[model samples]
Every structure is written in structure tokens, then in C-alpha cells.
Target: MVMSRRKTKVNALLSVLISLGILIFINVLNQSFFKRFDLTSDQRHSLRDASVEIVEELEDPVFVRVYLEGEFPADFKRLRNAVKQILDELRAYAGENIQYEFINPSASNDPVKKKEMYTKLSESGLTYTNLTIRTKDGVEEKILFPGALITYRNKEIPLQLLKSTNRVPSPEMMQNSINNLEYNLLSAIHQVTQTRKKKIAWIGGHGEITGLDAYDMVEHLAERYTIFDVNINEKLNALIGYDLIIIAGPKEAISEKDKFIIDQFIMKGGAAMFLVDGLQADMDSLQSQNNMMALASNHNLWDMLFNYGVRLKRDVLMDAACAMIPINVGKFGDQANLKMFPWYFHPTLITTKNHPISANVNPVFTQFLSSLDTVGNDKDIKKTILLETSPLTLRRMAPARINLNTVSIDPGFEKNSIGKTPVAVLLEGKFKSLYANRLTPNIEQDTLIAFQEKALLDTRIMVVGDGEITKNYSNRQTGTVYPLGYDKFLRKIVYGNKDFLANAVDYLLNDERLIKIRAKEIEVRKLNDRKILAKESEIQLANLALPIIIVGVFVFIILIIKRRKFS
Candidate 1:
């Protein structure tokens, strides 16, 4: 009796310990224990790791307001769900500092007040769209817009609604846009909640694209930057206040005085982008001469680029994989050929293995391209080709005649015969100005600054062989705006040669952390049909006999053990 009592007591003590352990586990899970698991694929959680850092560093609450209404249209349901999923993930990852609210305007049918609020929002430059639906007997519509407005401190930033025409969003395009949003938002929150905006300058003059054309890029970056346009002729030291400067596609030659100003800007550690064209394009002549292409190479800025370790050759590059346009040649008739203009010679540029400037950018487009040569191996200057032509490319010298008939890829062209050609290049490091020792040329005088003796600036510069690739040229005969290639207006707008140029600028400015966003891994899994079939047959046989086999083995083992014990 005493032994049995002692055994029972020991069993009771073990049971109590197990019960206490289970209770503690349940309590921990109810609090914060289960949150440690990263049960998300990379696709669904691109910013998961970064978000944790952001939350930990966050000192204040971020208020997010989303404007959505009852029962969305069938076409918009996918977008709505995607937005909700992203917001939920952000909230979870951001911890207690991220607060969200959903607002439905239709809930309150007061038109006067609703219109007043909408007008205020519209005046603030917030974009919204209406969704219309037609029933059997009547028509019903709802105003659906991006409902989230995030506020850090007293500053408010709105999140625009994302919609795609295709049922499924293009993974590449969607990822680019989302990555842009995450970076912009993080920077905004960081600044508004803490520091001031950084200043940047866009160099005017030399016939570059106006600030109006760059409004979208400017606005996207304005949340964390103060952007302004300055002409080098106006004030040279005016750029001193800015952290970066941008020199867009310049038509006219850059004067030595202006070049001195730019050199000084770089010397002060100000970053700049030089989107130079190798050949000068005359649209009027091309249109008047029946689209006869002419090459214009005489530019005063070639010396500067040469001194900076890049040579823009005076040749037009044509690739067999060109963009097509409808041309009425009057002989082959009005059919599409793999032409060079509307369909640009899109160089499948291989970006540097580890550089932010080329991250996530698809192939870039170039027309009337010039070859770039690296001159004088400067130890401080690092140059890499950001864009290049395929091996099946040929270069045509300028002042050569070109017509629609000369645009097609020759069937006899061989890849091994032609070598790989560089179309665009990225240069980073200290650069010596070409005018370092030379006297300032005769030009209108501004407050001239002395050029730096050593490399003035640690900067990033992108040189493109062609400029016409980014220009939007329309045919006078047809009112249609010709695209470099392909259909779909959004693709034309977002992924065009201009888009590539804009992406280059964004990368240079370092406004968007595009380099950090990982590319989607292509999962390629194939089934072995024969092996699978054999395995299926084996599994079926085992399922049928497993129970019987187990029972027989148990009986044999028991009988053998009993016989041994008796003997």
C-alpha cells in the first residue's frame, strides 16, 4: 500500500508540472510569443524586414486614413483587396505606431458638406476617380478613390489608389510602383517626423527639357526634397545651396563659363546627371525630307565629356530587334516594319552587378546613338556601361542617307560577325574638368568661379548615345502619337525611353531606395511524370496492405517473446 501511494504521488506531481507548463505556453502565445514567426513568402513580404527597423526607430504615431465605400465594382475588387492586404501587413509590421482608419463618404448623404470636403482635397492635388455600373433597368455609380491619407506630425501625405486595366497586375510594373511608394513614404515619415527637406537643383539653359516636363518626378521627390531649376548663366554659386543638380538632355553646346559652374557644383560633392545625345536630331528636316534621317555632330560639349572619360561617337546604331511603325512607303504599301523611331533600338542594357542606378530598370531605348569610349584611366573615376547593344547590331556613320526602306533587319546579318557595342554608360568618381588649364572662352560673363585643381566632385553621371529616344515626335500627317514600340498607353507612358531616363535621374538623386527592393525569383518546378506514376501505384498498394502487415508482425513478435520466456 505504501509503495503504491508513493507512485501515485509522483504521478500527481508530474501531471501538475505539465499542466502549469501548458498554461504558461498558452499565456505567452496569447501575448507576443506567436508573433515571432515569419510565415510570409518574399513576394508577399518584400518590406517585412525593413519595416521592423522602421517601427523600432519610430518615435511617433503615423495616422493613416483610407477612403473606401460599400460594395466595390467587380473590376475593382482585386485592387481593393490588394490595398487592404498591403495596409494590414504594414500595420502588423509597424507595430503600435501605425494607426489606420477607413472612411466612406457615401455613409453620410450630405452633398453640400461632401462636395466641400472633396473640393478641398482636390485643390490639394489629390487625384480621385468615379466608378460607374449599369444595371438591367437603371445606372448606379460610386466614387472610389485611394482612401489612405497618412499623417506624421502635422504634415499629411496621401496614398493614391492603384488600378490596373489587366485583370492581373504585371509583376514587374507593380513591384516598381510599390517599391517606389514604400521608399517615398518612409522618407517622408522620417523627415516630417524629424529633419528638414534636402535641396536639389535642375540646371536649365543648353535647351534641356523644361521643369514642366519633369513635374511628376519633382513632385514625387518633393516630399523629402526642395527642387528648383537654375540656369548656369543666371547665377553659378546659386547651386551651392543644393545637394544635387540635374543636367537633362541639352541641345545646344555648353559654354566654358557654364561648364566651369557645373564643375564647381560637382567639386562641392553635388551629384548630377548628364543625359547627352551623341548625334543632333532635326525633327523638322526628318518630317520635311519625307522622314529622311540627318546626323548633326558639331557640339561644343564633346570636349568636356571626353575630358570626363566618356566619348560620344557620331554614329547611329540600328538593331534588328527594333520597334515597328506603320509607314506608307507607296511601294511596299502601308505596313509595319521593324523601324527605328516609334520602335526604338531598345538595348537590353545589363546594369552593373551591384549599383542602384540600374536596379529594376528594364531595357533602355536609344536612337541615333554614339559609341562611348573610356579615356585616360583615372584611378579615382569608375566608369561602367549601363546600356549596350546586342551582338547583332551595326553602326551607321552620320551624314548618311536614311529612309523607311533602310530600317529593316537584314536577314544576312550574323551575331558572331558584329561585336557587342556600348550604348549608355554610368560614370562615378572625381572627374577633372576639360577646361581645367584652358582660358575661359569668350561668352557672356557671370560671377565666374575657378575650376578645382583636383577632382572637384564625387558624382554620378549617365551618358546616353542618343537623345531622340526620349523626345516625343508626332507625324504631321497622322494625329496619332507614335510610340517607340508596342500597344497600351500606360506601357508607353510608364516604360518608354523617357521613363528609363526618369528612372536614371531618380536613381542618381537617391530619392528612392530602389536598389534595396529585391527582384522576384522565378520559381521553375517540373513534375517527373513517370516517377510520379510509379510512386502513386506503390502508395495505393501500401494503403491496402499496411494494416494487415502491422497486425501480423505484432502477433509474430508476441508469440516469439512468450516462447522464449517459457523456455
Candidate 2:
């Protein structure tokens, strides 16, 4: 009996040691490698390869402070959970390099402290949401910021978690913001950690947009690029070093010398964005004088553009689906009465879903827009329409007259606007030089014009018929500079112009990592409310009893095992 007892004790001791040894081995293996298994079919919990790469390559720790804690609503809570999960996934790959904290800006009980927190976030470029919560007592209001600040290597970058449409939030919009959680976080990290800034040449000295009118976009672009004001100035190598030239609505003509310079730049694989208005007309003129003529503005590069595979129509594109402008309908008791009317000249360009550049983008609004036609059929080039007018459209050529009375061509007169035209296009391929035969010695940078008839490298060019897409408006009298896509008349109606420009830039630069994340459609599985309501009692009973049953079964199994061992 003593020998039997000694044997049992030895076996038990071995079992304990073996269990501890297995645990230690597991701990060592976990330390050596990190892995996460996501079994969901949609891979909702998984990070993209691009995101993992960014985190894994982190030279320093990336700390994100998310101001989404202490949330009241279910949607906000879901968003908060998603942010944490993404950070956790990143941390799993990056180990200690990825870190995050959920902060509540409104956590302080003191009103002064909370106010200061909000102010700080606002100044740091983070926006807050005005949330209305319906409670048992009554309706309550709350201010919450669906944004975060990512700090990497001592630089803090603001990331907006929710993309505000300047309108009421729809259920789908909330889910979209949730779906893009990974992108928002990693983009901020990538932005701050990036050492080299790509140079962007802002074409100027031809009356292109500047100052507050372009400040918002310029600021946003500067976050991702180093912007320089470049004047072609009839130089052979004026735009030579720039990766991309942003030609934001040059009011004056582009000299052939400068045009040739731009052409050569493209021949060498440089990208250019043309926000040109074929007609020289703006609302500022019509608003003051009540009438103006949209004459054909000469930019003097028509042949060059045609050769490159697009013809910017020298006309005004008017659409029935358009924006509203305050117009003087009639007089009201000694006050010049102003009433809101649909301005068809300012059409909201519909976004095309087929292309990543414009996929899921909101309708872009433009003024005095022109149509584009793909010409020359360059076998190497690919023309994808990014934005176009709705089928209910009317396009009138230059020498077109614009007057306040023209809102009379409102949505009611849809029959006249039965035509559709593409207002923006993305041209990509190896382009043939327009100056193949006309090349001279001075045209070449280092040597005599070594005119290559065909492209030595592939390139891309974005052609938008409306200059207004790149222009931001400011109330000169009040000095209030509105955002690039904010609607002046209707505050709620915001355009997708800024997003369109950002995506276009990314695509042109051949960097679509963030764009790919934005394009990801996360499927939200909604519960069937009717079925839930029908089986409410059963569901509640199951929920209340299932946990107890599970615990009882576990306890019973444990007791049986203990009894067997003792026996």
C-alpha cells in the first residue's frame, strides 16, 4: 500500500510539472512569434496587408489618443470597440510599437476643463459631433468628437474617425465610418512617420487660385506633400523637379513655351491636374451685376490636350440636378427680396463607382462646368470618366449668357436638359509627344532637343472641365474662408470636391493604399426586427437561462473528474 501511494504521488507530481512545462513552452513560442486567427468570413477583425506592413515597419512607437470613450450611444460604442480592436490587431503584429488609449474629452465634471479640452481638439484640427440622445426623462444633447490624434516620433497628426457630410447622419454613413477605422488610424501613422515629402508644384503667375480661396486644400495637400508655387515663366525646366503640377484654374493663357515644358514633363512620367474653365464666368460677377456672359477663355493649349487624348469643350454644362442659389425673385416691402432657386449652371457632378478615384465619393458640385470628349483614340492611353453630369442635362457653347433669371431653367424644365456629358476624366498611359517634329536644341534640359517621338515612361493626367472644383470661397467682407466643399447657400449641402481631389492625387501618384481601405465595403449584419419582436419572450428566456446551464454543466463535469481522481 505504501508503494502504491508513492507511485500515485510521483505520477501526480509528474503531471503537475508536465503541465507547467507545457505552459512555459507556449509562453516562449508566443514571445517568439505573433499571430491572430480571424475566422469571420468577411475577415472583419483582420487588418489589411498594407496596414500590417506599416505597423510592422514602425521604427518608433505610434501612440494614438482616441477621444471616443464614455460614449452614450450604441453606434459610438461600436465605433469605439472597433478602434480598440484595430489597435489591438496592430499591436499584435507590432508588439509594443503600436499603442492607443481611449480618452473622453467630456469626462471632466468641471465645465471649464471640458470646454478647454474641446477647444484644444478643435484647434488641433479635430471636429466634434452634436449628438442628441433620447432618454427616459427627455431628450439630452451631447458633444462628442469622432476623431483621434496619432503621435509618432513627436509629431501629432489629427485623424477624423467620422467623415462628416455636413448633413444629418444616416445609418449607412455611421457604418461606413466604422468600416474605415483601420484606414483612418494607419493613414495618420503613415503621414507622421513618413520622412520624405513628395513635391507638388502649384502652377501660378497665370492668375491661378491663391490665398484663402485655396488655403484649405493647400493646407490639406501640404500635410501629404511639400507644395511650391511654381511659375512656368517660359522656362524649359520650370516644372522639371516637381512630381505633380496642380494647375488650379489658370485665368490667363499658358504660353506655348510653358505648354511645351509641361508636355516634356509628362513625357518623362510627371503627372498634371488641370482644373481649367473653358468659359471665363463666375457667380461673383453675376451676383453683383445680376447678369454676365460666359465667353470662351483662351488657354492656348487645345491642340496639346487633343493630342494627349481629350478635348475640353469650350462650353457651359448645365444640368437639371443642381445646387440652390439665393436669387432675387421679387421685391418684399422695400427690401430687395431674395429667394432660393435651383441653379442649373452649378451642377453637382455625379461620381462614377467603377473607378477607385471616384468610387463611393459624394456628388461633386461645380460652377460653369464644361464637358470633355476623349479624342485621338491613343491605343496606349486609358480614359476613365471620374465625374459626369446626369442624363438630365443641357450644354450650351461659349458666348452663353448667364443671368439670375436662368434659375428659371430649374428642375421643372427637365425636358431641355436631356443630354449627358462627362465633365472630368482620368487619362493614363505612355503618351506620344506633341512636339515630336517641332523640337529644337533649347527644348532639351542637358542636350540639344533629343526629341523622342514616343513616351520614354508612362504618365497620367487628370482633366476636369470645371475650375470651381479646386476653388474655395471666402466672404471677403466678413473674411470667413469656407472649406473647399462647403455649400455657401445651403449649409447642409456639402460637395465631395475635396475628397475627389485627394483621391485623384493619390491615384495619380500611384499610391492607393488609403484609397483601397476607403473603398472596402464592410457588410453590416442587421438583426431582423420583425422576427426578434415575434420571438422576444423565447430569446429573453434563452439568454437568461443559457449561461446558468453552461455553468452548471461545467461545474458538474469538474465534480465528476474530482470524484474519479479521488476514487
Candidate 3:
């Protein structure tokens, strides 16, 4: 018996030593090498190759200050946890270069101090959301700013953790926010770490929408790019320093010289976006004047665009899937009865599913948009439809008359729009010069010219048939421009023009891979409410009693083993 007891003690000591040795070995290996395992169905925890590369090349530390801490709802808790996990993952790859801390903006009870902090956060470009909380005493309101600030080197960028999409409740918004966490964090890091800013120019001489009319989009683009108002004015080198040029909704025709300059720019591997209005239709004119007629406007770029592989039709698209405008229907003396009616001329363009620019994007609202058709058999030129009108759409060939009196008259329009009509198109590849074999412009021979009849390098072009897609509405009274894609009367987002335009810009600027990250999808698996309600008692019992039962069984098994050993 004595010999057996001594042998058992020796075995126990050996087992303990072996376990310690194994743990120490694991620690030593982890210090030199790092690996992470993600077994999720969608691999939500995995980082993109671009993200990994950016983090690995970090010469300076990135400090992230997240303001999503403190006691909150379960959904917010999940979001906070997700942010923590992504930061942790970034830190793993970035090593000591990634630093982060969670901050509770409302932690202090002092009102003055709290107000001061709120001002600071707001001044730092953080916005807040008002949330209502209920308790036994009464209902109270709390303001929460679900945002973060990331700093790298001398630059910093603000990230709104909770993206507000079409106004929704916290549960749905939180889930959407969680889905976008990776993209938001990664994009912010990229922006802060980026040392160079690309130059973007808006073509000015072609009578395009300018100043406050294009304020919202211009402001958004200015965040990451240096914007310039450029005019060709028969200058060959007008577009020399520009990485990309946007011909946004030009009202007048482009001159031949200007077209040649643009064509030569494309031939030399420069990118451009043409937000041209194919048909002349104006909502302001309809509202102010009695005669409502739309004439086809030739911006003189049709030949150029056709050569580039797209033909923008001189017609307006009317769709059943459209926005509504309030109409006054009461007598002159009586109280005006305002009723909402569908405006067929303003169709909401459906986003394409496969393309990164349109994937998972909301419908883009367009006014007087024209249909686009691909031209030419150039195998080098590839065209993809990015946005289209829904199947319930019909094209009204210009000179089309728009009457406001038709709002009350229900002339049953058939669903002729059975097929998707392309409105926005992306053209990419080696483009053949439009000016090839055509009369050369009158210029001195000493001028520097690329003179490439075909594309020297692969380039991209985006053709949006409606220029209104880039226009923002301003309050008539205050003269304040509303955000792009926002509808003030309906108090809801009618389209995603801002995101669509931004993505197009990014794609044209040669940030395709980074923009493609916005297409990442995360499936939200929700419990069946009906089933949960039906078996509420059973679920509660299992949750409450199962833990106790497990503990009881474990303790019982331990007691039995002890007794057996003693015996």
C-alpha cells in the first residue's frame, strides 16, 4: 500500500509538470508567430488582404478612440463587442502599432462637464443619436454617439460606427452597423495612413451644375480628394494634373475642342465620369410654369459617348417604382387638402446586384433619367449596367409633355416595364479614340501631344444618364442644401445617390479593391419570434435550470470519484 501511494503521488507530479511545460511552450511560440481561426459561416472575423497589408506596413502607431462603452441595450453591447474584436484583430497584425481604448462619453455625472465633453465630441465631427429608455419610475431619454476617432501619424479620421440607413429602429440599425464594422474600421485606417491625396477635377466650361447646386456631392468628395474646377478652353494640357475629371450634368453642349481634350485624356489612360442629361426635363420648370414639356438636349458628346461604347437615349423614363409629391386638391377658399401622388418622371433607379458599386446599395433616385444602350463591337471595351429602372418602366420619347393635372386622373397605365432599362453604365478597357481619323484641331506642331489613336493603357469611364443624380436640393427659405439623396417632404431617403456616386468616383480613381470591400455581406440570422413565444416557458426553464443541473452533476461525479479513491 505504501509503495502504491508513493507511485500515485509521483504520477500526479509528472502530470502537473507536463501541463505547465506545454503551456510555456505555447506562450513562447505565440510570441514569435500569430495565427487566428475563424469558423463562422461567412468568415466575419477574417480580415481582407488589403486590410492586412495596410496594417502590416504601419510605420507609426494607430490610436483608435471608440465612444461606444457603458451600460446599454443588448444590441449596442453586441456592436461594442464587435468593435473590440476587430480592433483586437488589427492589433494582432499591426502588433505594437495599433492602440485603442473605449471611452464612455457620458460617464461623468456633472452636467457642465458633460456638456463640455459633448461639445468637444461634436466639434471633433462626431454626431449623436437620441435614445429613449423606460424604467419603473418613468421614461428617460439618452443621447448616444456611436462613433470612433482613428489617428495615425499626423492625420486623423472619424468613423460613425452606426450608419443611419433609411430611418429604422435600434435593433435593425445595430445589426447593419455590425455588418459594416470591418469596412468602416478598415477604411478609416486606410484614410488616416494614406500619405498622398488624389486630385479630382470637375469640368466647369460645359454649363454643368455648379456651386451650391452640387454642394453635397462636392463636399463628400472633398473629404478624400483635392477638387478643382477645370475648363479645357482649347488647352491641350487642361487635364494634365487631374487623376479624374467629372463632367457633372452639363446643361450646354461640349465644344469640339473640349471633346478632343477629353478624348485624348482617355486615350492616355485617364479616367472620367460623365453625368450628362440626355433629355431636358426640369422639376422646377414644371412647378413654376403652365407649359410642361421636355425637349431633347444634345450636349454634343453623343458621338464621343457612342464611340466609348454607350448611347444615352434622348428620352425620359417613367417608372411605377417612383417617388411621391404632395398635390394641393382643395378649392381656393377652403383648407388645402395635400395628397401624395406618384411622380412617374422621377424613377428610383435599382442598383445592380453583382457590381461592387451597386451591390447591396439602396435604390438611386433620379429625375428625368434617360435609357442607355451599349454600342460598338470593340472586344477591348466592356460595358456593365450599374443602375437601371425597374420592370414597371416606360420610356417617353422627347419632346414629351408633362402635365401636372394628370395627378388626379387615374388613366390605368399598364406595366410595360417588364425588363430592366439601363440608366447608369460602367465602361472599362482600352478605348479607341473618338478623334481618330477625324479632322485634327488647329494647334501648333510644337504642342505636347500623346497622339495615341488607341488606348496606351487600360482606363475606366462611368456614364450616368441623369445629371440630377449628382444634384442636391436646398431649402427655398434658408438656402441650405439638403444632403444628397435625401427627401425632405417624405422625411425618408428616396435614393442612395450619394453612395452610388461616391463608389463610382472611387472606382474611377483606381481604388477598386478598397471599394469592393463595401460589398461584403453578413447574414443576420434571427430567431423565429412565433416559436420563441410558443415555447417561452420551456426556454426559460432550460436556461435557468440547465446550469444548476450541470453543476450538480459535476459535483456529484467528483464526490463519487473521491469516494472510490478513498475506498
* Candidate number of the best TM-score: 3
lDDT of candidate 2 over 11-55, digit per residue (tens): 999999999999999999988886778898888888888787788
Candidate 3 regions with alpha-carbon error over 4 angstroms: 1-21, 24-35, 69-79, 104-123, 127-145, 162-175, 331-333, 405-418, 441-445, 525-567
Clashing pairs in 3: 391-417, 393-417
Candidate 3 has its poorest 10 consecutive residues by lDDT at: 439-448
Better of 1 and 2 by lDDT: 2
Candidate 2 steric clashes: 1
Which ranking of candidates, highest lDDT first? Answer: 3, 2, 1
Residue-level lDDT of model 3, residues 82-116, one tens digit each, is 99998998888998999999999999999999999
Q: Any idea what lDDT model 2 has?
A: 0.83
> Which candidate model has the greater TM-score, 1 or 3?
3
lDDT of 3 at 215: 92
**Candidate 2 lDDT score at position 434:** 87
